[model samples]
Target: MKVLYNHEYPRRVRLAAIGCGGHAIRNVFSTHPYAPIDLVAVCDLDRERAEHTGCMFGAKAAYTDYHEMLEREKPEAVTVVTNYDEDGRPRYPQIAIDCMQAGAHVWIEKPPAASSAEVLDMMRVSEATGKFVAVGFKKMFFPANVKAREIITRPAFGSISTITARYPEALPPLEDRQDLHKMWRFLDHIVHPWSVLQYLAGPAESIFVQRSPTGGTVTAIQFASGAVGSLHLDRGQGSSSFLERTEIVGPGGNVVIHNNTKLTFYSDGPKPAGGYGRSGDYYGGDERAALHWEPEFSLGQLYNKGIFLLGYAPEIRYFCQCVLDDTPPEVGTLDNALEMLRIYEAYCQPDGQHIRIDTEPGKVS
Candidate 1:
């Protein structure tokens, strides 16, 4: 795939943005040159932020109200990045609905909603409007994870049998789980590993979560594909440490991704140099050696940019491709958000017992 500059595309979708906050500025807007967008305008509740972002991005139109921006700009696509309300309800859901209703497709930031019902509501509206919506499930877009995805699905890897993910997350105390504001931290970040699991193993059908007194959790999940997986929530890990690890095991081999950048795939290759027990050397032939990949930062390259390495650019580029080609996005859809939120809701329930995740429509179970 070719990475195009803003001017390289023959025609570009007219794009406007809601919320010019730090994330929108640093990650979303920075991807403009890599995605095919005309950048019609910018909107934020604060006048100075709206104007400043518009000026910074060469968008001449600026509005404090998204409604005004949507109506006046007539953009074909809109990207939203907003924080939570006083009640801990994310602002992205309602804004995304508004964007879809205004005849534009949407690309919204994560923590898509506070509940599964909210995600369902977005789903219903998206179907009604014939507008596609993409959520920011960034981990699924990470270069290393993307490569792992490709490697595992190839015929060489055989069929996936298990998955293991480690991420630093803590479940709220049982008493605090009932409060949306208190549980906000869990909702905001759990998707990092959960989305990766879904992206690799498909939807989980059942889960049994066990929590520690120290606030950590270990969840055993049964995927609909019949692949079992475990998610390790390392609650007390230091802030400076590398954040994540994902490993997928198949009958033929296992692939591992470290901190979302380095990837190593161990296929069922031949034994060591002379044989398993007879070899003096541990190394094997190059044809059957573990395949490894990681980005090099010494040179200037699109893949080396934080925007690309962290998935911000790729996700935006994907959304833009879906809009440009008029194809529905298979990744980061509201259906995926609903599944992720179902798992979040399961965490709210009393742990120890297995919780079955339902796939039906309507209110959250």
Candidate 2:
């Protein structure tokens, strides 16, 4: 619930941003004022876009070349949001590696790479430069998802047994899977469900995907901890419908998030006064009732802002906090990116088979 304005923060990291695309402008740069950083410059390949975005925000300068921006501005950290390479691989890994080599930490947007091998290269660069790279796995920062993670970690929650997620996405056909460009869409969007899933249920070891004729898919996952899960990528779901739902179950209860905002935690309640069908009262004690939360937009609260509600500000803050503290980020680290990319690689394989994901923790198979 902490809200710190960029200008008011007595000491802030020197931040520069690359990529002036719609998403970077809307979600990332829009959050600059709320994060703990002084945006020194904006960079993009398009000079007009760079200048426009820099002027829109309060950046002191703008440049068309990021390498030039890095050398001239010497920002302590940089946020990168870029398009994928022609091969369908994200441009982030190489960009982030370069940022680290420039002696600055990096915050890059998701789908960190097309494969685990690329993430591993980023990891190597990060270690060599001693600068951490934080991927924008925003769902991990979503307030509801954060709350769900908290609820699941409580001792009262018992062991996490399962996770179920639904997202409106479609997988490429088996034939198309061999081509990175053909997998462009799946690589871009699958990270949403997988980010929330991995954020809740750590370290999955395998996945079994079954694709519907219409391109929807039901992916079953087995975690290293012995928990099982499923993701329903509803390809043909209504566009107007809410995009996502995620739930994690524990022996004591479960927590669910709907549409990235509303959350309900159903905890184990007191035993009924009577047994089974004989129980007359459906009500439970005050403390045992289900806990629920969702932001109210009426007052213009920070939580009501799309940036905060959808996790952009929090993600930026988390990365900035790490930079300010001179420590590696705990969330959205290269390890997390690597883990998710491994699962992404699993998706690139033929569907309808139980593909084993490499689980050696950041080691590319």
Give the poorly placed runs of model 1, Cα more than 4 Å off: 273-276, 360-365
Could you give candidate 1's per-residue lDDT for residues 1-365 as a string of tens digits? 56889889898889999989999999999999888888899999999989999999888699998998998888999999999998889988889889999999999999899888788888888888899889999987988888888999999787789999999989988899989989998999998899999899888999999999999999999988889999999988988999999899998899999988899998898877776578997767777788889989999999999999999999998999899999889898888899889889999999899999985544422
TM-score of each: 0.96, 0.97
Query: Per-residue lDDT for 33-103 in model 2, tens only?
Result: 88888889999999998999999998999999899999999999999999987667789988898899999
Error of 1 at 18 (Å): 0.3
**Counting only residues 3 or more apart in sequence or on different chains, how many pairs clash (N, Cα, C under 3 Å) in candidate 2?**
0
Could you tell me the TM-score of candidate 1?
0.96
Q: Superpose all Cα atoms of candidate 2 onto the true structure and report the RMSD in Å to 1 decimal.
A: 1.5
